[model samples]
Every structure is written in C-alpha cells, then in structure tokens.
Target: MRLSFPKLAHLDIRRGLMMVLWLQVAIAAVMIAGDWLGRNPPGAPSSVPGMSDPVAPGDQRRRFDPDRPVPRRDAPALPPGIDLPSTYPDRLTFERKTIEGFGDVLLLNGSIATGDADRLSSYLDGASTEDLPATVALSSPGGQVIEALAIGRMLREAGKNTAILPGMACMSACPYILASGEQRRVSPEGYVGMHQHYYDENLYMPAYFAVEEIQRGQGRTMEYLIDMGVDPGVMIYSLTTPPEDIYILLPEELLDSRLATEMLD
Candidate 1:
C-alpha cells in the first residue's frame, strides 16, 4: 500500500539525517588518514634530529634528476688562533701523557691518514694491558675522512671520553672523532674547527663523483651523530664551509650541538 504524504516526508527526513551522519564519519576518517601519512610520508627523512626511522620495506625512494645544478659552499673563516697546516703530517702519532689532575690521557696528534686507525688500535691494546686512558685528547689538522671515522668508532666502542685539551687543536675530521666520546670536553684554550669533507684532492673531479662521495659521507656522518645522540644540525656549519677554510664553532654553538658537554676552566 502507498504511504500517506506526511509519512513519506518523515521517512525522507530520517534518510537525509542518516546520510549526513555517514558523510561526517567518512570525512573524519579521511582526515585521520591524512595526518598519519603526513607524519610517516613515503621517502621522507626523519624530521627529528639525531633519530633515524627507516622507510617501510615496501616504500619506494624518491629520486631526483642528476643534471640539476648542485649548490656550492662558501669559504669559511679560519678558526680563531688556528693556522691551517702547511702540509699533511708525515705520520700520526699517539702519545701517552699524564695531566696534573686528569690522570693518564692519550694524545692523538698529526694527520689521520690511512693506517692511523690501526696504529690507534694497537696503542689502545697495549695500553689496556697496563691501564686505559681516562680520556683521549685530540690535536690534529685533520686528514683521511674514513680513517677518522674508524677512529671515532673505536673510541665509542672502547667507552673512552674525548677532549680538546688546553693548548691544543682539533679540526676537520677531528671533530668527527671527538663525537665518539662518552663525555666530551673542551678547554677554553682548545680549538675545534670544522669543514666540508674532502674526498678527493683533484680540483677538477667529475661533478657526479663528487656529489656521490659527498652524499655518502653525509649519510655516514648523520648516522654517526644519531648514534652518539648528538644533534646533526652542527653539520650545517661544516657543510657551509669549504674544505680549505674552517668553521670555528662559538662556545654557545658547541654547547648547542652537544659537541661539548662541558667546558673546562
């Protein structure tokens, strides 16, 4: 039987209200999904400094065109009171020194060239037989990037502290090694300068190779910072500085980057 006009009108109103409620639910669902995606977008790096959240296994990496012009870095000022090394060191040497109050400390001076990490390892092994150093002091003009990185890993694994002691300098890859310290200290008279990674000596290296090397080193450094719980933002200064000059971090900048947990008086 056909419904009365009044009953039909009532039925229509109910159906309309139900439809509106369903539409509202659908909109809310979409919004929730959008927010989730924004936080864990495909191929996006972690926004939080010193943390790595790898992309899900199935996520595709975003690739950029190779022909794009790469950005250039400006020359940075030499660190105050530091003179660039006239030449790479003949060799890296590890010295055992005793500080007046700090007890035994290992001193790493000169260039961090190839085989330097092996030398450091041998030193540590021999020293451990007697007594390990309370801290490893760095004073170098910097050298091989990979050697410095290896040295840093060894320091971290050995659970030793690192420092730029008074009347000393630590520049270039030295800062990377310094980051491995369980505790890092910088004396007022100490220096820690930073610069972009130097992968090759050839000035006319291919752009593609240079970019590739830089990206590789950048990834390693970022990972190292995260592992050490240090803020990777410190790299901003390094990346901006050309390989020739140095970017000396002010006291506040050093503290901000967590590079110096304490500054000795």
Candidate 2:
C-alpha cells in the first residue's frame, strides 16, 4: 500500500499551547507591578506636590495672611499757622510823683522816652535847676545808654539824692543812672547786671566797626560812672560779667558792698 504520514500526538500539542499562555500571563504581571511602584512608592505620602496643609483659625498666619489685604491708619492734619498775640504779658510802666518839701521826687519810670538828643537836651534845660529833684526808681531791662548817662549826669550835678528802690532791678545803663544818685537804696529784691552794649549791625555797619563803636561807648559810660563816685571794682565787675550773670545784690549785700547807702523794707 501507500506510506502514511506520522501524525503528532495531541498531548504534546496541548502542552506546547499551555506553555505559551503561561509566558504571556507572567509578562503582564511584571508590567502591572512596575507601574504601581512608580505611582505610589514606599515611605512617601500621597498628596499634591505644592499644596500646603490647612491652618488653624487661631494661628498667626491666619491673622495676617499674605493673600489678604490690610487696612491703613489715617493721621491727623496740622494747623495752618500759629496765632501769637502782639502784646506780651509783661510790660514796663513809668509813673511820676512830687514831694513838696523835698522839691520833687521824680520817679523816673524806666519806661519813659526822652526821645532824641535835641529833645532830651531841651527837657533838661527847661527843668528848674534851683529845685532840681532827685530821681528814685527801679530798673531791670536797660534802654538808651545816652539818655541814661545824661540823666545820671544831671542828678550828680544837681546834688540830688538818687536812689535805687530795692526789690527793683537796675541793669545795664540803669546802674549808671543809679551811680549818679548821691544815695543808692536797695530793696530786698534788688539786683544789678550788665551786658555788652548791643546795636543792630545791619542798621549800622560791619561787625568789626560796630564792635569798635560799642567799645568806645562802653568806655565813656564806665568813665562817667566812675567819675560820679561809683566804685571802680563794681563797675569793672559789671562790665566783665554777662547780662545774665550780672551782679545780684540783696539789700544787705548791697549795703555791705557800699553800693547802697540805705536798705528799704
């Protein structure tokens, strides 16, 4: 007859098919495990990359959050200008009086204005020389030196008793006037001081020139006071000391220095 082809066994074929299926299943399992490991690794928390945790209501961060805007504070406005009064509280006043038997005790108020040289000269000329009265006054803030000196000379020439009322302050040129008095009186509150003679430079001249003039004027003033019988030492001390540091003499102190002939209560 004819040679027939040998047929393969069914069991061998089935075993080969089973081996192929097992290989495919193993490869699928390996791929699934790798994907799981990359997505969720061990020891790492599962959260969005940049997201922060929720904060408590009482936390400081919650109070002043960067995302929130803050309210601004308003400030008060300033006044446009200051309202200062023209007149000051303290003002000097001069009062005059007459003593019948004593001729006339002219209380040269520190506030009196004898005006310019011509006017002052006329006033002095008109004054009666026979019954020229003494001047009794208290002075603190000094005024025109020329006027003060003129009054001083007049008092000295008339031989009238010039008195500085104590508790009263005689300062600057005022002391020169006091020196003119034949008698100086100091009250409990009497004080005397001197300052460098001051003049307006802008109204006069350069500083050096003004200073020279002041010095000359001061020298003349000192000479007049000294010649009129004021102690040279006292005048020197006054000239040297600043106005603020001028001599302060009580009634007793003045009497001790011979600056005052009498002390009034």
C-alpha lDDT score of every prediction, in listed order:
0.68, 0.49
In terms of TM-score, the best-performing candidate is 1
Tens digits of per-residue lDDT, candidate 1, 1-265, equal 9767885566677798998999999886776666456433677563321101122222212111111101112223323433434443556777777776566677776877889889888888776544677688887777787788889999999998998866566777878888889999987556676777656644344444468777887888889888886899999878866453555566677788999889877
Candidate 1, position 205, lDDT: 45
For all predicted structures, in order, the TM-scores are: 0.64, 0.51
C-alpha positional error of residue 2 in candidate 1 after TM-score superposition, expressed in Å: 94
Tens digits of per-residue lDDT for model 2 on 135-204?
Answer: 5554434556776777677667766566544323465556667777788765543445454444332322
Prediction 1 TM-score vs. true = 0.64
| Global local distance difference test of model 2 | 0.49
